[model samples]
Target: MRHYDLVILGTGSGNMLLDEEFDHLRTAIVEPDRFGGTCLNRGCIPSKMFVITADAVEDARSAARLGVHAHVDPVEWKAVRDRIFNHIDPLHDSAVNYRREKGVDVYIDEGHFVAPKVLEVKGEQITADTFVVAVGSRPVVPGTPGLDSVNYHTSDTIMRIDELPASMVVIGGGFIAAEFSHVFSAFGTCVTILQRGPRLLTAEDEQVSARFTELAAQRNRVLLNATVTSVEPHGDGVSVTVACPDGTHVIEAASLLVCVGRRPNTDRLDAAAGGLELDEHGHIVTDSAYRTSVPGVWALGDAVNHFQLKHMANAESRLVRHNILHPEDVRTLTNRVTPHAVFTNPQIASVGLTEQEARRREMDYLVNVRNYAATAYGWALEDTTSFAKILASPADRTILGAHIIGPQAATLIQPLIQAMALGSTVDQVASGVLYIHPALTEVVEQALLAL
Candidate 1:
């Protein structure tokens, strides 16, 4: 049997485990497909590349409102798509090469747990003192009737398309749905979002979700509370039958995109052989220290049921590394405020608790909101859409949540994230700091003052 001190399954953030600190310890990595995992190959990096181009196209179209009178030429899909892949594909290859050059044993195959501390990879048996499972997640396809017969694209396969469809019917209203909706819509496709819920962006604050729905409606049709019963392939298109409170409605489009959610890729790992427990969602159950039910086994990233963001995964990877190095000094991955940003037009970003969550908990919170139009920079840009909302606890004036919907909303929410992570009070953000005049961040400062 091949032996090593450490063996890490999956190479997403798990690759971070190969720090110089672990150079003394013999390590082996097993990866089935790409080296950089989903974030680099398919998820975050690629999606953002497409979204940024869409943003540029949208900006050019709206230049008339900004007094620029700019006309957007046709988007060369092939050229644009090829450029992104050209940049990313090489980086992916280099990542794999770097791991090997660093003297880490790299095994490119599917790895399955055969026993508590043993993993079988590509017909080879390997044992390690400690093992890390970070296999990540994949798109979950629901069991809808006729879905198999109809042609559809998922987050993983959508970007590799030869060309953009003329029109698309998007199923589900999650982050994947919203991001793609904006991408395709900005690219001149007639986009329609079919959400089964009452509103889109269910994970965000209710007010923010409602406002997002309104803004999205301006660009494309948003069908809310519509449950799809069946989908069938038409000639070069798809027919969707949805049952809603209004009644049954059928729609057709050139393509259908599924953005429902993702499922943990734990089934193939044979975790049961290692005596590790998984939740009902198939995510590995880990303690605050990222230790699995089985000794010598640790899990993080999407494979675990914690925050699924790339930054969060990297953070957990560091925590697991620390625990592995010094079992005596344990660290917990809790009490840290997690922030999420959605990349839609009039982008949405938020951290900490929602107003509704605070109210439900009865946490003595005060709410304050500032319209983006109220800012001087807002007038210079001729902006009349979106707002910033802040929620703070009354007793200590600590920022519980900060939500924004406007240009650079994702960038503007970072200060609040710093405050929440550092446990800074609202007064510190509002009075102690000096925001550049006529900047987008001033809007954040204004909201904090109101709180």
Candidate 2:
């Protein structure tokens, strides 16, 4: 058995903790797979690169509406996949090499704690005075009958496929389904989305969900209120049986992308053995200061956070670092104003409460909506199907939430996020700020004013 000052259990956000302050301590980082973790290798970064290509292709397809008709070239799947991975793979290597050179012991093997503060990695027993569990999450493959016999892809594997499938059947109603559907459909592959929920992005405000569903349905076959029963092999492809409100039907496609959701990696960690607590969903239980049930044990990122976003993970990582270093003056995470965005066609960005959540909580709030078509920039893009939604407390006029769906929705919603984070009011955002004329942000200004 060997002991160390610290042992961080993941390379995702955990990789960020090796700052100058920690350089004096003996530390080890355990990463069983890729060095940079999910967001870099599979999730956000590379996926967005793919979405960028889809965006360009989509713009060309809609160019005729803007009186600039041009045909897009057929997508070369090999070239696209190579371009992203070729660049990202090297960066992962560089991260690992750089960390090792900094006097940090890097363990490229699966590891878990056998006892409190003790970890077992590749037949070696190691102990640390303090430990950080940042192991992330993995795609959950639902147990549908015969699913094992057929070929299917999760978010992890789908992007690396050698060639684009002729057509695809996306299973789920979340951001992954919407974004991938956009990518494949825009790349000229036929796409059909089978969602168990009544609508896509069910977590969003109801109106925004309806509008996204409306626009998405125009581009791909969307089957809502769908329950997938089984998956099986079908002549060089896969066949999916779905139980819809109408009736049970079989849909065949060259590939199946299961985007149902992700599950935390805590189960594999055997947390109970280490006297660590976990939630019902198998997420490691942690306090606001990122401390686990057991003293000297901390967890963050997808392994513990409700919001499994890279930015949130980074924030939590920094908080954990501060708390670990200054145990006497521990700092709790300030995550009340976290924002998220989905990179799909007519992209979606949101911060704060959804109207449903507010109503469910019985909070007194004022909500308002503004259509993109009403804005000057909307006329330039000829956009008709997008809008911005804002909710604010009437008493203080404090902006509680903001959601946008349209071009640059991710970038446009940032100002609203800033307002909420800075405790700004709806009127303040609309009147106090100077919004550029004929900009898409005018749509946001309009929404705030309506509030």
List the candidates' TM-scores in order.
Answer: 0.97, 0.98
RMSD to truth, every model: 1.3, 1.0
The collision pairs in model 1 are: none
Query: Best candidate per lDDT, number?
Result: 2
Tens-digit per-residue lDDT, 168-277, candidate 1: 99999988899999999998889989999999998789999999999899999888999999999988999999988889988889989999999888998888787889
Model 1 regions more than 4 Å off = none
Tens-digit lDDT string for candidate 2 (1-451): 8789999999999988888899899999999999778999989999999999999999998999989979988999899999999989998789888989998999999998788888899999999999999999999999999889988899999999998899999999899889999999999899999999999999888888998999999999999999999898999999999999999989999999999999999888888889999899989988789899999999999999778899999999899899889889999976579999999998999989999999999999998888889988999989888888999998899988988998999999999899888898788889997999898899999888777
- Each prediction's number of clashing residue pairs: 0, 0
On TM-score, the leading prediction is 2
Please give the distance, in angstroms, between residue 107's alpha carbon in candidate 2 and its true position after superposition: 0.7
C-alpha lDDT (0 to 100) for residue 60 of candidate 2: 90
Tally clashes: model 2.
0
